[model samples]
Target: MKRELKVTSDGSKTLYMENWDECYHSVHGALNESMHVFIKNGLNEVEADSLHILEFGFGTGLNALLTLSERGGRSIQYTALEKYPLSEEEWNAVAYGRTSEERVAFASIHLADWNAPVEIESGFVLKKVETGFEEVEFEPNSVDLIYYDAFAPSAQPELWTTELFTKCFQTLKPGGFLVTYCAKGQVKRNMKEVGFEVMALPGPPMKREMTKATKPSNV
Candidate 1:
């Protein structure tokens, strides 16, 4: 079952279950936070003409949409993992508002087929993997960036554990960045245990801090 959630003062659409809330995009402004973390901090530093990106929770396809819009000079192979994905109708109801340029970009993401990789535009290929995070398999040292935007630790503790971080660390190339809105101490410790150098940074409004973990070249 799918239900709309009220996030933030702007009343952006968030998805929720009995206790779990996913995707802060709607409440936080999708494009705004994505650009800040992924584009500014992660993707901009990737010098490769082609890059592979992995996102843990592909809610509303907001990160995918924003990334496609900003991919000017490089080709991106984007893979997103979602277990209980939103239906097409549910996805449509989420308003992207009058942001014509971004709205147009966002529309293309939902129209893409699941599992089968689709080229939404030149230099941007998106593939939706309808599997849980634990079941999904990624090639070691292949991913350039990881958007670890799962629910909070209280809601989904498994996603924040050392085992999960170990899997994520194995998937990333040396120097790749893992960016998430979570700043919990346990999450940081898990990342460190998995060989990531964690950094705490300022978060969006109403949030105190966020975390960015980087895999070292030697690891």
Candidate 2:
């Protein structure tokens, strides 16, 4: 799988996989999509003193970097899953971290050890899990939020199956929510089949819709 660096619409870089015709983030704007989909729509929806988040497809650690940067006085325990971790060459090619502080944060995120939790900074603990989403096991009712940032269903249909979303339902606490850039009808149906209250939200640039699935509080 050969990956090349592509400058997105927002001047940020994303990995373009020639083999799968897939990209690590949206081509419209890599940073734009991440902030809109994962931060605004996902993290902002939850209001708590502390949060436990499970993210699928860690990719270049962009989402984690953004979340850590937005501390807002709340503590976050982040567990990210990455089946195919990015190599140093791929990540280094990204043109992020304009400021010296941001550059340091980016370096700290990528340098963290895998399969073990490390406090990248005060109030931000990150655990990088080197495993596939389906193969990973999570403690039931433990996660408060799920960033389902896996590749599109077209690229990896197995990750979008009803069974996997069922596992997501079980892993999340009551009233927890899962967010993703995908809003395909079948994907929404699969989430519904597993007792998730699904909603279609506005997508990022060059896209139409995104999905936000929630576990009911009473269930």
Q: Which model scores highest in TM-score?
A: 2
Deviation (Å) of 205 in candidate 2: 1.3
In candidate 2, how many Å is residue 48 off? 0.4
- Worst window of 10 by summed lDDT in candidate 2: 89-98
Clashes of 2: 0
lDDT of 2 by residue, 1-219 (tens): 688899999999999878778999998999999999999998888999899999988998999988887758799999999978888777878946857887798889898999999999998999999998889878999999999998888988999999899999999999999999999999999999989999999999999999999999998
Model 1 over residues 26-112: C-alpha lDDT tens digits?
356555566666677667767888999999999878778767767786899999999888877777776553479777767878878
lDDT of candidates 1 onward, in order: 0.80, 0.91
Model 1 residue runs over 4 Å out of place are 5-7, 10-12, 21-31
Q: Estimated TM-score per prediction?
A: 0.90, 0.98
